[model samples]
Target: MKRIFDISMSLIALVVFCLPLLVVAVLVKLTSKGPALYWSDRIGKNNEIFRMPKFRTMRIDTPAVATHLLGDPDQFLTPIGHFLRKSSLDEIPQLWSILKGDMSIVGPRPALFNQDDLVKLRTEVGVHALTPGLTGWAQINGRDELPIPVKVDFDAYYLQNRSFLLDLKIILMTVYNVVRSKGVSH
Candidate 1:
C-alpha cells in the first residue's frame, strides 16, 4: 500500500512539477558549476546503498561532508540555495527517488554513506530495517535539530507502528510544517 501511495504520488507530482523542476535545473546550472541535482550515497533498507537525489543547495566546492560538521556554513550556499533549503524546495527532486523505490514518503531519513556513527546506531536500533523516507516521524518532529539518538528513537517508533493512517497523519503534518517552514534546522 505504501509503495502504491509513493508511486502514484511521485508520478503525479513529477508531472505536475516538471516545469518548475526544469526552471530550477536551469537556475542551478546558471548559478553553479555542478549538476543541478546532487546525488549523495545513502543507506537503504537491509543496508543497501543508493544515490539519493536532491536539488543542489550548496556550493560544489563545499566539503563533501555534512553541514552539521561545518563552520560558517552560509558561505557554502549558492545564490538561491538558502531559499531552496529553507523552503524545502530542494527536496522536490526526491520524488524521483520515491518513484525508483529508493525512498518512501514516510519513514526514517536515509543516512549518508559516510555517517557511520548514525548508520551503526540505526542498525543497532533496527531503524535500517525500513526504507528511508522523504519525511517521517523524525522530520515532522524536529528534523536536523534533533540529536542522532532522538532521531533514531523516532525512526524505531515509525518502524514499529507505521500504518496508512500514521503515514497520512505525517503527510498532513508535513504540509503544515512546510507551509510554516518549521522543524528544519540549518
Candidate 2:
C-alpha cells in the first residue's frame, strides 16, 4: 500500500512539477559549473546505499560531506544555492528516486553515505529497516535544526507509528513547513 501510494503520488507530482523542474534544472546549469542534478550516495532501507539525485546546490569543488559538517558551508554555495536550499527546490529531483523505488514520499529522510553516526544510531533503533523519504516527521518537526539523537528519535517514532493517515498528516505538514521555510539552519 505504501509503495503504491508512493508511486502514484510521485508520478502525479512529476507531471505537475515538470515545468518547474525544467526551469530549476536550467537555472542550476546556468549558474553552476557541474551538472544540474547531483547524484549523492545516500543510505536507504536496511542500510543499503543508493544514489539519490538532488538539484546541485553546492559547487563541484565542495567537499563531499554533510553541509553541517562543512566549515562555512556558504563558501561552497553556487550563486542560487542558498535560495534552492531554503526553498527546498533542490529536493525536487528526489521524486525520480521515489519512482525508482529508492525512496518514499514520506519516511525518515536518507542520511549521507558517510554519516556513520546517523546510520549506526538508526540501525540500532531498527529505523534503518524502513525506506528513506523525501520528507518525514523529523523534517516537519525540526528539520536541520534537530540534533542527531533527536532526529533519530523522531525516525524511530515514525517507524513505530507510520500509517496511511500519519503519512498524509506528515505530507500536509511538510508542505506547510516548506512554505514557511522553517527549521532549515543551513
Candidate 3:
C-alpha cells in the first residue's frame, strides 16, 4: 500500500511539476558549471547500494563521500545550492528512485555509502534493514541539526511504528517545515 502511494505520488508529481523541474534544471546549470543531475551512491534496502539522483546543488568537486564528513562542506556548494537546500527542491529527482522502487517517499533518509560511522551506527541499531526515503522522520524532526545517533533513534522508532497515518503526518510536517523555512541546517 505504501509502495502504491509512493509510486502514484511520484508519477503525479513528475507530470504536474515537469516544467518547474525543468526550470530548476536550467537554473542549476546556469548558476553552476556542471550537469543538472547528480548521481551518487547511497545505502539502500537490505543494506545494498544504489545510485541516488538529485539536482546538482553542489559543485562537481564535492567529495565523493558524505557531505558532513568533509572539513568545510559549505564551501563546495554553488550560489543556488543554498536556495535549493533551503527549499528542498534539489531532492525532487529522487522521485525517480521511488518509481524504480529503490526508495520510498517516507522512510529513513539514505546515508552516503562512505559514511562509515553513520553506516556502522545504523547497522548497530538495526536502522539499515529497510528501504530509504526522500523525506523522513529525521528530516522533519531536525534535518542536519540532529545528531546521527538521534537520527538513528528516530529511524528506529519509525521502523518499529511505521504506518500510513504516520507517513501522512510526516509529510504534513515536512511541508510545514519547508513553508516556514525552518529546521534546515544547510
Candidate 4:
C-alpha cells in the first residue's frame, strides 16, 4: 500500500512540479559548474547503498562530506545554492528515487554512504530495515537541527507507529515545514 502510494504520489509530483523542476535545473546549471543533478551514494533499505538524485546545491569543488561537517560550508555554495537549500528546491529531483523504489515518500532520511555512525546506530535499532524517505518524522521534528541520536530515536518511533494516517500526517507536516523553512540548519 505504501509503495503504491509512493509511486502514485511521485508520478503526480513530477507532473505537477514539472515546470519548477526544469527552472531549478536550469538555474543550477547556469549558476554552477557541475551537473544540475547530483547523484549521491545513500544508504537505503536493509543498509544497501543506492544512488539518490538531488539538485546540486553545492559547487563541484565542495568536499563530499555532509554539509554540517564542512567548515564554512557557505563558501562552497554556488550563486543560487543558498536559496536552493533554504527553499528545499534542491530536493525536487529525489522524486526520481521515489519512482525507482529506492525510497518512500515517508520514512527515515537516507544516510550518506560514509555516515558509519548513523548507519550503525540505525542498524542496531532496526531502522535500517525500512526504506529511506524524501521526508520523515525526523524531518518534521527538527530536520537538520536534530542530533544523530535524536534522529535515530525519531526514526525508530516512525518504524513502530507508521501507518497510512501517520504517513499522511508526516507528509502534511513536511509541506508546512518546507514552506516555513523551519528547523533547517542550512
**In terms of TM-score, which candidate is stronger, 1 or 4?**
4
**Candidate 1 structure quality by residue, lDDT tens digits, 1-186:** 889989999899889989999999899889988899999898998889999999999988988777888897788999989888888989999998898899998889888888888899889988888999999999999988998899889998988898999999999999899998897666
List RMSD in Å for every model shown: 1.0, 0.6, 1.1, 0.6
lDDT of 1 at 153: 90
Quote model 3's TM-score.
0.95
Q: Stretches of candidate 4 above 4 Å error?
A: none
Task: Give per-candidate clash totals.
Answer: 0, 0, 0, 0
The sequence of per-residue lDDT tens digits that candidate 2 reaches over residues 1-186 is: 999999999999999999999999999999989899999999999999999999999999999999999999999999999999999999999999999999999999999999999999999999999999999999999999999999999999999999999999999999998899998887
lDDT of 1 at 52: 92
Pairs of colliding residues, candidate 2: none
Top-lDDT structure, candidate number: 2
Model 1's lDDT to the true fold? 0.89
Residue 130's lDDT within candidate 3 is 80
Per-model TM-score versus the true fold: 0.96, 0.99, 0.95, 0.99
Q: Which should have the higher TM-score, number 2 or number 3?
A: 2
